[model samples]
Target: EQKAVLVTGCSSGIGLRLAVLLAQDAKKRYHVTATMRDLRKKDKLEQAAGDALNKTLSIQRLDVCSDESVAECLNNMKDRRVDVLVNNAGVGQIGPIESLSMQDMQKVFETNFFGAVRMIKAVLPDMKKRKSGHIVTMSSVMGLQGIVFNDVYAASKFAMEGFCESLAVQLLKFNVNVSLIEPGPVNTEFEMKLMEEVGKSQFPGADAETVRYFKEVYLPASHEIFTTLGQSPDTVAKATMQVIGMRLPRLRYQTNALYTPLVALKYADESGSLSVRTFYNLLFNFGPLFHLSMNLIKCITCNCFRRGAVSPS
Candidate 1:
Protein backbone atom coordinates (compact mmCIF):
# COMPACT_ATOMS: atom_id res chain seq x y z
CA GLU A 1 0.00 0.00 0.00
CA GLN A 2 1.49 3.32 -1.09
CA LYS A 3 1.66 5.89 1.69
CA ALA A 4 -0.42 9.04 1.22
CA VAL A 5 1.94 12.00 1.57
CA LEU A 6 0.77 15.60 1.68
CA VAL A 7 3.22 18.51 1.39
CA THR A 8 2.41 22.19 1.73
CA GLY A 9 4.16 25.14 0.01
CA CYS A 10 4.93 23.01 -3.03
CA SER A 11 5.02 25.85 -5.57
CA SER A 12 8.83 26.06 -5.40
CA GLY A 13 12.09 25.31 -3.60
CA ILE A 14 12.51 22.32 -1.25
CA GLY A 15 8.77 21.72 -1.06
CA LEU A 16 8.47 21.40 -4.83
CA ARG A 17 11.46 19.09 -5.08
CA LEU A 18 10.27 16.88 -2.20
CA ALA A 19 6.79 16.42 -3.64
CA VAL A 20 8.15 15.58 -7.09
CA LEU A 21 10.81 13.22 -5.74
CA LEU A 22 8.26 11.26 -3.71
CA ALA A 23 5.91 11.04 -6.67
CA GLN A 24 8.75 9.67 -8.79
CA ASP A 25 9.73 7.08 -6.19
CA ALA A 26 10.97 3.99 -8.05
CA LYS A 27 9.18 1.67 -5.67
CA LYS A 28 5.88 3.55 -6.21
CA ARG A 29 5.53 3.77 -2.46
CA TYR A 30 3.85 7.18 -2.34
CA HIS A 31 0.83 9.04 -3.60
CA VAL A 32 1.42 12.75 -3.10
CA THR A 33 -0.83 15.77 -2.72
CA ALA A 34 1.17 18.93 -3.25
CA THR A 35 -0.40 22.20 -2.11
CA MET A 36 0.17 25.94 -2.23
CA ARG A 37 -1.78 29.01 -1.23
CA ASP A 38 -2.67 29.87 -4.82
CA LEU A 39 -3.09 27.67 -7.85
CA ARG A 40 -1.86 30.52 -10.08
CA LYS A 41 1.69 29.99 -8.73
CA LYS A 42 1.58 26.25 -9.47
CA ASP A 43 2.93 26.28 -13.01
CA LYS A 44 6.48 25.82 -11.79
CA LEU A 45 5.56 22.85 -9.64
CA GLU A 46 3.52 21.34 -12.48
CA GLN A 47 6.46 21.64 -14.85
CA ALA A 48 8.74 20.03 -12.29
CA ALA A 49 6.44 17.13 -11.45
CA GLY A 50 6.19 16.25 -15.18
CA ASP A 51 5.10 12.62 -15.59
CA ALA A 52 3.94 12.38 -12.00
CA LEU A 53 1.31 15.10 -12.40
CA ASN A 54 -2.24 13.83 -11.99
CA LYS A 55 -0.87 10.29 -11.83
CA THR A 56 1.01 9.84 -8.58
CA LEU A 57 0.87 13.55 -7.67
CA SER A 58 -1.90 16.16 -7.51
CA ILE A 59 -1.93 19.85 -6.67
CA GLN A 60 -4.43 21.72 -4.53
CA ARG A 61 -4.91 25.15 -2.98
CA LEU A 62 -4.18 25.47 0.71
CA ASP A 63 -3.58 28.52 2.91
CA VAL A 64 -1.91 27.25 6.05
CA CYS A 65 -3.00 30.33 8.00
CA SER A 66 -6.65 29.70 7.28
CA ASP A 67 -8.48 26.97 9.19
CA GLU A 68 -11.21 26.60 6.58
CA SER A 69 -8.74 26.13 3.75
CA VAL A 70 -6.86 23.49 5.71
CA ALA A 71 -10.11 21.66 6.47
CA GLU A 72 -11.38 21.77 2.90
CA CYS A 73 -8.12 20.49 1.39
CA LEU A 74 -7.90 17.51 3.74
CA ASN A 75 -11.61 16.76 3.37
CA ASN A 76 -11.27 16.57 -0.40
CA MET A 77 -8.54 13.94 -0.17
CA LYS A 78 -9.52 10.37 -0.95
CA ASP A 79 -10.42 8.57 2.32
CA ARG A 80 -9.14 11.72 4.08
CA ARG A 81 -5.98 9.69 4.47
CA VAL A 82 -2.55 11.32 4.79
CA ASP A 83 0.19 9.01 6.07
CA VAL A 84 2.82 11.77 6.09
CA LEU A 85 2.26 15.49 6.52
CA VAL A 86 5.15 17.76 5.48
CA ASN A 87 4.63 21.29 6.81
CA ASN A 88 6.99 23.22 4.56
CA ALA A 89 5.06 26.45 4.31
CA GLY A 90 6.83 29.39 6.01
CA VAL A 91 7.60 33.10 5.72
CA GLY A 92 10.83 34.79 6.84
CA GLN A 93 11.46 38.07 8.63
CA ILE A 94 14.76 39.91 8.30
CA GLY A 95 16.29 43.23 9.53
CA PRO A 96 16.66 44.39 13.10
CA ILE A 97 13.63 43.90 15.36
CA GLU A 98 13.47 47.62 16.09
CA SER A 99 13.35 48.47 12.39
CA LEU A 100 10.77 45.78 11.52
CA SER A 101 7.08 46.46 12.04
CA MET A 102 4.89 44.81 14.64
CA GLN A 103 2.58 43.76 11.83
CA ASP A 104 5.40 42.13 9.83
CA MET A 105 6.71 40.25 12.86
CA GLN A 106 3.23 38.93 13.61
CA LYS A 107 2.83 37.89 10.00
CA VAL A 108 6.06 35.91 10.24
CA PHE A 109 4.87 34.05 13.34
CA GLU A 110 1.40 33.50 11.86
CA THR A 111 2.80 31.76 8.83
CA ASN A 112 5.95 30.20 10.21
CA PHE A 113 4.76 29.04 13.61
CA PHE A 114 0.95 29.16 13.88
CA GLY A 115 0.51 28.25 10.25
CA ALA A 116 2.39 24.98 10.81
CA VAL A 117 0.41 24.36 14.00
CA ARG A 118 -2.82 24.77 12.05
CA MET A 119 -1.78 22.05 9.61
CA ILE A 120 -0.68 19.73 12.42
CA LYS A 121 -3.95 20.27 14.27
CA ALA A 122 -5.89 19.67 11.06
CA VAL A 123 -4.15 16.30 10.50
CA LEU A 124 -3.30 15.04 14.00
CA PRO A 125 -6.63 13.46 14.92
CA ASP A 126 -6.72 11.38 11.78
CA MET A 127 -3.10 10.37 12.31
CA LYS A 128 -3.70 9.46 15.95
CA LYS A 129 -6.76 7.41 15.12
CA ARG A 130 -4.83 5.45 12.53
CA LYS A 131 -1.85 5.01 14.87
CA SER A 132 0.51 5.52 11.91
CA GLY A 133 1.79 8.83 10.61
CA HIS A 134 4.78 11.14 10.30
CA ILE A 135 4.82 14.91 10.77
CA VAL A 136 7.79 16.60 9.14
CA THR A 137 8.53 20.33 9.49
CA MET A 138 11.04 22.55 7.67
CA SER A 139 13.19 24.28 10.25
CA SER A 140 16.41 26.30 9.86
CA VAL A 141 19.86 26.48 11.42
CA MET A 142 18.56 29.68 13.01
CA GLY A 143 15.98 27.55 14.79
CA LEU A 144 18.84 25.84 16.63
CA GLN A 145 21.31 28.74 16.72
CA GLY A 146 20.23 32.36 16.56
CA ILE A 147 21.62 34.73 13.93
CA VAL A 148 22.03 38.48 14.11
CA PHE A 149 19.46 40.61 12.19
CA ASN A 150 17.32 37.47 11.74
CA ASP A 151 15.79 37.83 15.18
CA VAL A 152 12.10 37.48 14.38
CA TYR A 153 12.53 34.73 11.84
CA ALA A 154 14.64 32.79 14.29
CA ALA A 155 12.10 33.34 17.06
CA SER A 156 9.31 31.94 14.93
CA LYS A 157 11.32 28.81 14.22
CA PHE A 158 12.26 28.59 17.89
CA ALA A 159 8.54 28.55 18.65
CA MET A 160 8.11 25.67 16.22
CA GLU A 161 11.04 23.81 17.83
CA GLY A 162 9.45 24.06 21.27
CA PHE A 163 5.91 23.32 20.10
CA CYS A 164 6.84 20.21 18.15
CA GLU A 165 9.29 18.97 20.76
CA SER A 166 6.54 19.02 23.40
CA LEU A 167 3.90 17.59 21.09
CA ALA A 168 6.16 14.78 19.82
CA VAL A 169 6.20 13.17 23.27
CA GLN A 170 2.42 12.88 23.49
CA LEU A 171 2.07 11.76 19.86
CA LEU A 172 4.49 8.89 20.48
CA LYS A 173 1.82 6.95 22.36
CA PHE A 174 -0.38 7.11 19.24
CA ASN A 175 2.52 5.97 17.04
CA VAL A 176 2.88 9.36 15.34
CA ASN A 177 6.38 10.61 14.56
CA VAL A 178 7.34 14.29 14.52
CA SER A 179 10.57 15.16 12.75
CA LEU A 180 12.28 18.53 12.26
CA ILE A 181 14.53 19.04 9.22
CA GLU A 182 17.00 21.82 9.97
CA PRO A 183 18.94 23.14 7.01
CA GLY A 184 21.51 25.93 6.95
CA PRO A 185 21.65 28.45 4.11
CA VAL A 186 19.56 26.57 1.57
CA ASN A 187 20.10 27.78 -1.98
CA THR A 188 16.56 28.76 -2.88
CA GLU A 189 14.91 31.65 -4.66
CA PHE A 190 13.34 32.52 -1.33
CA GLU A 191 16.82 33.16 0.14
CA MET A 192 18.01 35.02 -2.92
CA LYS A 193 15.06 37.34 -2.58
CA LEU A 194 15.84 37.83 1.10
CA MET A 195 19.43 38.78 0.30
CA GLU A 196 18.23 41.29 -2.30
CA GLU A 197 15.88 42.82 0.22
CA VAL A 198 18.64 43.02 2.77
CA GLY A 199 20.76 44.95 0.35
CA LYS A 200 18.02 47.48 -0.44
CA SER A 201 16.22 47.87 2.87
CA GLN A 202 16.45 51.31 4.46
CA PHE A 203 16.01 49.97 8.02
CA PRO A 204 14.31 53.20 9.10
CA GLY A 205 14.12 52.72 12.86
CA ALA A 206 17.69 51.51 13.30
CA ASP A 207 20.50 53.96 13.91
CA ALA A 208 23.10 54.60 11.21
CA GLU A 209 25.83 52.60 13.01
CA THR A 210 23.52 49.62 13.49
CA VAL A 211 22.49 49.79 9.84
CA ARG A 212 26.15 50.00 8.84
CA TYR A 213 27.00 46.94 10.93
CA PHE A 214 24.07 45.09 9.40
CA LYS A 215 24.82 45.97 5.78
CA GLU A 216 28.62 46.04 5.99
CA VAL A 217 29.62 43.35 8.48
CA TYR A 218 26.73 40.93 8.46
CA LEU A 219 25.79 41.04 4.77
CA PRO A 220 29.23 40.15 3.44
CA ALA A 221 29.59 37.33 5.94
CA SER A 222 26.13 36.10 4.99
CA HIS A 223 27.08 36.07 1.33
CA GLU A 224 30.28 34.20 2.17
CA ILE A 225 28.32 31.72 4.29
CA PHE A 226 25.89 31.04 1.46
CA THR A 227 28.63 30.64 -1.08
CA THR A 228 30.52 28.22 1.14
CA LEU A 229 27.93 26.13 2.97
CA GLY A 230 24.63 26.44 1.16
CA GLN A 231 22.81 23.26 0.27
CA SER A 232 20.70 23.16 -2.90
CA PRO A 233 16.97 22.50 -2.63
CA ASP A 234 17.38 19.11 -4.31
CA THR A 235 19.93 18.05 -1.67
CA VAL A 236 17.55 19.14 1.07
CA ALA A 237 14.75 17.19 -0.60
CA LYS A 238 16.92 14.08 -0.74
CA ALA A 239 17.67 14.38 2.99
CA THR A 240 13.96 14.64 3.73
CA MET A 241 13.36 11.58 1.59
CA GLN A 242 15.99 9.68 3.57
CA VAL A 243 14.22 10.56 6.82
CA ILE A 244 10.92 9.35 5.44
CA GLY A 245 12.55 6.10 4.34
CA MET A 246 13.92 5.41 7.81
CA ARG A 247 12.24 2.64 9.81
CA LEU A 248 12.55 4.89 12.87
CA PRO A 249 13.09 8.51 11.97
CA ARG A 250 14.80 10.74 14.51
CA LEU A 251 13.10 13.71 16.18
CA ARG A 252 15.63 16.20 14.80
CA TYR A 253 17.58 15.71 11.55
CA GLN A 254 19.91 18.44 10.29
CA THR A 255 20.47 18.38 6.52
CA ASN A 256 23.64 20.50 6.42
CA ALA A 257 26.66 18.51 7.57
CA LEU A 258 28.83 21.65 7.65
CA TYR A 259 26.54 23.23 10.23
CA THR A 260 26.80 20.34 12.71
CA PRO A 261 29.83 21.65 14.55
CA LEU A 262 28.47 25.17 14.74
CA VAL A 263 25.21 23.90 16.17
CA ALA A 264 27.17 21.89 18.70
CA LEU A 265 28.27 25.16 20.31
CA LYS A 266 25.00 25.42 22.23
CA TYR A 267 25.63 22.17 24.12
CA ALA A 268 29.36 22.65 24.64
CA ASP A 269 29.06 25.09 27.48
CA GLU A 270 26.69 25.35 30.45
CA SER A 271 27.05 29.13 30.75
CA GLY A 272 26.37 29.72 27.01
CA SER A 273 29.59 31.76 26.73
CA LEU A 274 31.28 29.43 24.25
CA SER A 275 28.62 29.70 21.54
CA VAL A 276 27.89 33.41 21.99
CA ARG A 277 31.51 34.49 22.27
CA THR A 278 32.59 32.37 19.34
CA PHE A 279 29.89 33.82 17.08
CA TYR A 280 30.55 37.35 18.28
CA ASN A 281 34.23 36.98 17.54
CA LEU A 282 33.56 35.44 14.14
CA LEU A 283 31.16 38.23 13.26
CA PHE A 284 33.96 40.83 13.43
CA ASN A 285 37.23 38.90 13.09
CA PHE A 286 37.16 37.28 9.64
CA GLY A 287 36.95 40.17 7.14
CA PRO A 288 40.09 39.08 5.23
CA LEU A 289 38.93 35.45 5.01
CA PHE A 290 35.40 36.35 3.83
CA HIS A 291 35.90 34.63 0.46
CA LEU A 292 37.13 31.41 2.08
CA SER A 293 34.95 31.58 5.22
CA MET A 294 34.22 27.88 5.24
CA ASN A 295 37.74 27.39 6.59
CA LEU A 296 37.32 30.08 9.24
CA ILE A 297 33.92 28.81 10.39
CA LYS A 298 35.14 25.22 10.45
CA CYS A 299 38.23 26.13 12.46
CA ILE A 300 36.21 28.02 15.09
CA THR A 301 33.43 25.43 15.43
CA CYS A 302 35.74 22.46 15.38
CA ASN A 303 37.97 23.99 18.02
CA CYS A 304 35.01 24.89 20.23
CA PHE A 305 32.63 21.96 19.75
CA ARG A 306 34.38 18.91 18.31
CA ARG A 307 34.10 16.02 20.75
CA GLY A 308 33.66 12.77 18.81
CA ALA A 309 33.94 11.53 15.23
CA VAL A 310 30.74 12.24 13.34
CA SER A 311 29.09 9.18 11.82
CA PRO A 312 29.42 8.88 8.03
CA SER A 313 25.78 7.99 7.77
Candidate 2:
Protein backbone atom coordinates (compact mmCIF):
# COMPACT_ATOMS: atom_id res chain seq x y z
CA GLU A 1 0.00 0.00 0.00
CA GLN A 2 1.36 3.40 -1.00
CA LYS A 3 1.52 6.07 1.71
CA ALA A 4 -0.41 9.31 1.28
CA VAL A 5 1.98 12.20 1.98
CA LEU A 6 0.58 15.70 2.44
CA VAL A 7 3.21 18.45 2.41
CA THR A 8 2.47 22.11 3.11
CA GLY A 9 4.19 25.19 1.61
CA CYS A 10 5.24 23.42 -1.56
CA SER A 11 5.55 26.55 -3.69
CA SER A 12 9.33 26.65 -3.39
CA GLY A 13 12.52 25.83 -1.47
CA ILE A 14 12.72 22.74 0.74
CA GLY A 15 8.98 22.13 0.66
CA LEU A 16 8.70 22.12 -3.14
CA ARG A 17 11.85 20.06 -3.53
CA LEU A 18 10.70 17.49 -1.00
CA ALA A 19 7.30 17.18 -2.58
CA VAL A 20 8.81 16.63 -6.03
CA LEU A 21 11.38 14.20 -4.71
CA LEU A 22 8.81 12.04 -2.98
CA ALA A 23 6.48 12.15 -5.96
CA GLN A 24 9.29 11.13 -8.30
CA ASP A 25 10.23 8.16 -6.18
CA ALA A 26 11.05 5.26 -8.55
CA LYS A 27 9.29 2.73 -6.38
CA LYS A 28 6.06 4.73 -6.30
CA ARG A 29 5.88 4.36 -2.56
CA TYR A 30 4.18 7.72 -1.96
CA HIS A 31 1.30 9.69 -3.44
CA VAL A 32 2.18 13.32 -2.69
CA THR A 33 -0.38 16.07 -2.17
CA ALA A 34 1.87 19.12 -2.51
CA THR A 35 0.06 22.12 -1.11
CA MET A 36 0.71 25.87 -1.11
CA ARG A 37 -1.07 28.98 0.15
CA ASP A 38 -1.97 30.02 -3.39
CA LEU A 39 -2.14 27.80 -6.45
CA ARG A 40 -1.06 30.84 -8.56
CA LYS A 41 2.46 30.59 -7.06
CA LYS A 42 2.70 26.92 -8.10
CA ASP A 43 4.43 27.43 -11.45
CA LYS A 44 7.81 26.59 -9.96
CA LEU A 45 6.52 23.40 -8.39
CA GLU A 46 4.67 22.41 -11.56
CA GLN A 47 7.77 22.94 -13.68
CA ALA A 48 9.87 20.88 -11.29
CA ALA A 49 7.22 18.17 -10.93
CA GLY A 50 6.85 17.93 -14.72
CA ASP A 51 5.39 14.51 -15.58
CA ALA A 52 4.77 13.74 -11.95
CA LEU A 53 1.97 16.34 -11.90
CA ASN A 54 -1.51 14.83 -11.74
CA LYS A 55 0.04 11.40 -11.58
CA THR A 56 2.10 10.75 -8.47
CA LEU A 57 1.77 14.36 -7.28
CA SER A 58 -1.16 16.76 -7.02
CA ILE A 59 -1.21 20.40 -6.00
CA GLN A 60 -3.77 21.70 -3.50
CA ARG A 61 -4.59 25.05 -1.95
CA LEU A 62 -3.77 25.17 1.74
CA ASP A 63 -3.14 28.18 3.96
CA VAL A 64 -1.88 26.80 7.25
CA CYS A 65 -2.97 29.91 9.12
CA SER A 66 -6.62 29.25 8.32
CA ASP A 67 -8.52 26.34 9.85
CA GLU A 68 -11.01 26.45 7.00
CA SER A 69 -8.27 26.15 4.37
CA VAL A 70 -6.53 23.26 6.09
CA ALA A 71 -9.79 21.40 6.75
CA GLU A 72 -11.04 21.97 3.23
CA CYS A 73 -7.85 20.70 1.63
CA LEU A 74 -7.91 17.50 3.69
CA ASN A 75 -11.61 16.99 3.11
CA ASN A 76 -11.02 17.17 -0.63
CA MET A 77 -8.84 14.09 -0.41
CA LYS A 78 -10.52 10.84 -1.43
CA ASP A 79 -10.37 9.22 1.99
CA ARG A 80 -9.14 12.30 3.83
CA ARG A 81 -6.40 10.10 5.19
CA VAL A 82 -2.94 11.53 5.59
CA ASP A 83 -0.49 8.72 6.34
CA VAL A 84 2.44 11.13 6.44
CA LEU A 85 2.08 14.82 7.20
CA VAL A 86 5.01 17.15 6.45
CA ASN A 87 4.64 20.52 8.15
CA ASN A 88 7.06 22.54 6.04
CA ALA A 89 5.19 25.83 6.13
CA GLY A 90 7.07 28.57 8.02
CA VAL A 91 8.18 32.25 8.04
CA GLY A 92 11.46 33.90 9.07
CA GLN A 93 12.20 37.03 11.12
CA ILE A 94 15.43 38.83 12.01
CA GLY A 95 16.78 42.10 13.52
CA PRO A 96 16.58 43.41 17.11
CA ILE A 97 13.52 42.78 19.33
CA GLU A 98 12.99 46.52 19.88
CA SER A 99 12.58 47.05 16.14
CA LEU A 100 10.12 44.15 15.85
CA SER A 101 6.47 44.97 16.33
CA MET A 102 4.02 42.81 18.27
CA GLN A 103 2.11 42.10 15.06
CA ASP A 104 5.24 40.95 13.26
CA MET A 105 6.13 38.59 16.13
CA GLN A 106 2.59 37.19 16.16
CA LYS A 107 2.78 36.51 12.43
CA VAL A 108 5.91 34.41 12.93
CA PHE A 109 4.23 32.25 15.58
CA GLU A 110 1.05 32.01 13.55
CA THR A 111 2.84 30.25 10.71
CA ASN A 112 5.78 28.58 12.45
CA PHE A 113 4.25 27.31 15.67
CA PHE A 114 0.47 27.53 15.60
CA GLY A 115 0.26 26.47 11.98
CA ALA A 116 1.98 23.14 12.68
CA VAL A 117 -0.19 22.53 15.67
CA ARG A 118 -3.29 23.17 13.59
CA MET A 119 -2.32 20.61 10.96
CA ILE A 120 -1.31 18.04 13.58
CA LYS A 121 -4.61 18.45 15.38
CA ALA A 122 -6.59 17.95 12.18
CA VAL A 123 -4.79 14.73 11.20
CA LEU A 124 -3.90 13.23 14.57
CA PRO A 125 -7.37 11.92 15.34
CA ASP A 126 -7.54 9.94 12.10
CA MET A 127 -3.96 8.74 12.68
CA LYS A 128 -4.87 7.66 16.18
CA LYS A 129 -7.85 5.73 14.85
CA ARG A 130 -5.67 4.01 12.24
CA LYS A 131 -2.96 3.26 14.78
CA SER A 132 -0.22 4.64 12.50
CA GLY A 133 1.15 7.86 10.98
CA HIS A 134 4.28 9.99 10.63
CA ILE A 135 4.55 13.70 11.38
CA VAL A 136 7.62 15.58 10.20
CA THR A 137 8.32 19.25 10.88
CA MET A 138 10.93 21.56 9.36
CA SER A 139 12.69 22.92 12.42
CA SER A 140 15.97 24.85 12.71
CA VAL A 141 19.06 24.52 14.91
CA MET A 142 17.87 27.78 16.46
CA GLY A 143 15.17 25.72 18.19
CA LEU A 144 17.86 24.02 20.28
CA GLN A 145 20.20 27.01 20.59
CA GLY A 146 18.94 30.54 20.08
CA ILE A 147 21.06 33.05 18.18
CA VAL A 148 21.35 36.81 18.67
CA PHE A 149 18.89 38.97 16.70
CA ASN A 150 16.73 35.93 15.87
CA ASP A 151 15.01 35.96 19.25
CA VAL A 152 11.40 35.74 18.11
CA TYR A 153 12.02 33.29 15.30
CA ALA A 154 13.99 31.04 17.65
CA ALA A 155 11.22 31.27 20.21
CA SER A 156 8.71 30.05 17.64
CA LYS A 157 10.81 27.00 16.82
CA PHE A 158 11.50 26.42 20.51
CA ALA A 159 7.75 26.33 21.02
CA MET A 160 7.48 23.73 18.25
CA GLU A 161 10.26 21.62 19.77
CA GLY A 162 8.59 21.58 23.16
CA PHE A 163 5.15 20.94 21.71
CA CYS A 164 6.32 18.01 19.61
CA GLU A 165 8.43 16.55 22.43
CA SER A 166 5.46 16.40 24.76
CA LEU A 167 3.10 15.08 22.09
CA ALA A 168 5.52 12.40 20.84
CA VAL A 169 5.45 10.47 24.11
CA GLN A 170 1.68 10.07 23.96
CA LEU A 171 1.70 9.32 20.22
CA LEU A 172 4.25 6.53 20.69
CA LYS A 173 1.68 4.17 22.17
CA PHE A 174 -0.55 4.75 19.13
CA ASN A 175 2.36 4.03 16.73
CA VAL A 176 2.30 7.60 15.40
CA ASN A 177 5.88 8.78 14.98
CA VAL A 178 6.77 12.45 15.29
CA SER A 179 10.08 13.81 14.01
CA LEU A 180 11.76 17.21 13.74
CA ILE A 181 14.19 17.93 10.90
CA GLU A 182 16.56 20.56 12.32
CA PRO A 183 18.75 22.13 9.67
CA GLY A 184 21.49 24.74 9.92
CA PRO A 185 21.57 27.62 7.43
CA VAL A 186 19.80 26.59 4.22
CA ASN A 187 20.62 28.43 0.99
CA THR A 188 17.20 29.42 -0.26
CA GLU A 189 15.39 32.46 -1.63
CA PHE A 190 13.56 32.78 1.70
CA GLU A 191 16.93 33.30 3.40
CA MET A 192 18.23 35.72 0.74
CA LYS A 193 15.01 37.73 0.93
CA LEU A 194 15.27 38.04 4.70
CA MET A 195 18.87 39.25 4.38
CA GLU A 196 17.87 41.90 1.85
CA GLU A 197 14.93 43.07 3.95
CA VAL A 198 16.97 43.29 7.15
CA GLY A 199 19.48 45.56 5.44
CA LYS A 200 16.71 48.10 4.72
CA SER A 201 14.92 47.78 8.08
CA GLN A 202 15.41 50.47 10.72
CA PHE A 203 15.92 49.66 14.41
CA PRO A 204 14.08 52.57 16.05
CA GLY A 205 14.51 51.78 19.74
CA ALA A 206 18.05 50.41 19.54
CA ASP A 207 21.08 52.62 20.19
CA ALA A 208 23.35 53.77 17.36
CA GLU A 209 26.18 51.49 18.54
CA THR A 210 23.88 48.45 18.55
CA VAL A 211 22.53 49.32 15.11
CA ARG A 212 26.07 49.63 13.76
CA TYR A 213 27.02 46.28 15.29
CA PHE A 214 24.01 44.62 13.67
CA LYS A 215 24.70 46.09 10.23
CA GLU A 216 28.50 46.03 10.16
CA VAL A 217 29.42 43.09 12.38
CA TYR A 218 26.47 40.72 12.65
CA LEU A 219 25.29 40.86 9.03
CA PRO A 220 28.69 40.18 7.53
CA ALA A 221 29.50 37.41 9.99
CA SER A 222 26.10 35.82 9.37
CA HIS A 223 26.60 36.01 5.59
CA GLU A 224 29.99 34.36 5.90
CA ILE A 225 28.60 31.58 8.10
CA PHE A 226 25.76 30.95 5.66
CA THR A 227 28.09 30.97 2.67
CA THR A 228 30.59 28.61 4.26
CA LEU A 229 28.26 26.32 6.22
CA GLY A 230 24.90 26.48 4.47
CA GLN A 231 23.25 23.32 3.13
CA SER A 232 21.23 23.22 -0.06
CA PRO A 233 17.46 22.73 0.23
CA ASP A 234 17.91 19.38 -1.50
CA THR A 235 20.22 18.28 1.32
CA VAL A 236 17.47 18.98 3.83
CA ALA A 237 14.91 17.21 1.63
CA LYS A 238 17.10 14.11 1.64
CA ALA A 239 17.20 14.16 5.43
CA THR A 240 13.39 14.36 5.51
CA MET A 241 13.27 11.35 3.22
CA GLN A 242 15.54 9.48 5.60
CA VAL A 243 13.22 10.24 8.47
CA ILE A 244 10.21 9.05 6.51
CA GLY A 245 11.91 5.83 5.46
CA MET A 246 12.96 4.91 8.96
CA ARG A 247 11.04 2.11 10.63
CA LEU A 248 11.11 4.03 13.90
CA PRO A 249 11.90 7.70 13.37
CA ARG A 250 13.79 9.49 16.10
CA LEU A 251 12.40 12.56 17.88
CA ARG A 252 15.11 14.90 16.59
CA TYR A 253 17.46 14.78 13.62
CA GLN A 254 20.04 17.49 12.86
CA THR A 255 20.51 17.81 9.08
CA ASN A 256 23.94 19.44 9.16
CA ALA A 257 26.89 17.88 10.99
CA LEU A 258 28.78 21.18 11.01
CA TYR A 259 26.20 22.54 13.47
CA THR A 260 26.53 19.57 15.83
CA PRO A 261 29.40 21.10 17.80
CA LEU A 262 27.60 24.41 18.18
CA VAL A 263 24.43 22.70 19.45
CA ALA A 264 26.56 20.57 21.77
CA LEU A 265 27.92 23.66 23.47
CA LYS A 266 24.49 24.24 24.98
CA TYR A 267 24.26 20.74 26.43
CA ALA A 268 27.91 20.55 27.43
CA ASP A 269 27.47 23.35 29.91
CA GLU A 270 24.05 23.67 31.52
CA SER A 271 25.24 27.00 32.92
CA GLY A 272 24.19 28.42 29.49
CA SER A 273 27.10 30.86 29.65
CA LEU A 274 29.28 28.53 27.53
CA SER A 275 27.19 28.85 24.34
CA VAL A 276 26.63 32.58 24.92
CA ARG A 277 30.31 33.40 25.42
CA THR A 278 31.34 31.13 22.52
CA PHE A 279 29.03 32.96 20.09
CA TYR A 280 30.11 36.36 21.45
CA ASN A 281 33.78 35.57 20.95
CA LEU A 282 33.22 34.03 17.54
CA LEU A 283 31.30 37.10 16.36
CA PHE A 284 33.23 39.86 18.18
CA ASN A 285 36.52 38.73 19.73
CA PHE A 286 37.74 36.22 17.11
CA GLY A 287 35.82 37.30 14.05
CA PRO A 288 38.65 36.99 11.52
CA LEU A 289 40.00 33.77 12.99
CA PHE A 290 36.51 32.22 13.10
CA HIS A 291 35.92 33.11 9.44
CA LEU A 292 39.23 31.52 8.45
CA SER A 293 38.41 28.34 10.37
CA MET A 294 34.93 28.12 8.80
CA ASN A 295 36.36 28.54 5.30
CA LEU A 296 38.98 25.83 5.94
CA ILE A 297 36.32 23.44 7.21
CA LYS A 298 34.13 24.13 4.17
CA CYS A 299 37.00 23.40 1.80
CA ILE A 300 37.92 20.14 3.48
CA THR A 301 34.34 18.96 3.80
CA CYS A 302 33.55 19.74 0.16
CA ASN A 303 36.67 17.90 -0.98
CA CYS A 304 35.82 14.89 1.12
CA PHE A 305 32.27 14.73 -0.27
CA ARG A 306 33.54 15.12 -3.82
CA ARG A 307 35.90 12.18 -3.30
CA GLY A 308 32.96 10.06 -2.07
CA ALA A 309 34.70 9.70 1.28
CA VAL A 310 31.87 11.35 3.24
CA SER A 311 28.09 11.74 3.06
CA PRO A 312 26.78 15.26 2.53
CA SER A 313 24.09 14.69 5.17
Q: Which candidate number maximizes lDDT?
A: 2
What lDDT is obtained when candidate 1 is compared to the true structure? 0.87
The CA lDDT at 167 in model 2 is 98
Residue-wise C-alpha lDDT for candidate 2, range 130-178, written one tens digit per residue? 9999999998999999998889999999999999999999999999999
lDDT, candidate 1, 133-222, per-residue tens: 999999988888898888999999999999999999999999999999888888888877787777677888899988888888888888
What TM-score quantifies how close candidate 2 is to the native fold? 0.95
Clashing residue pairs found in predicted model 2:
none
Model 2: residue 50 alpha-carbon error in angstroms: 1.2
How good is model 1 by TM-score? Answer: 0.94
C-alpha TM-scores of all predictions? 0.94, 0.95
Error of 2 at 24 (Å): 0.3
Ten-residue region with minimum lDDT total, candidate 1: 304-313
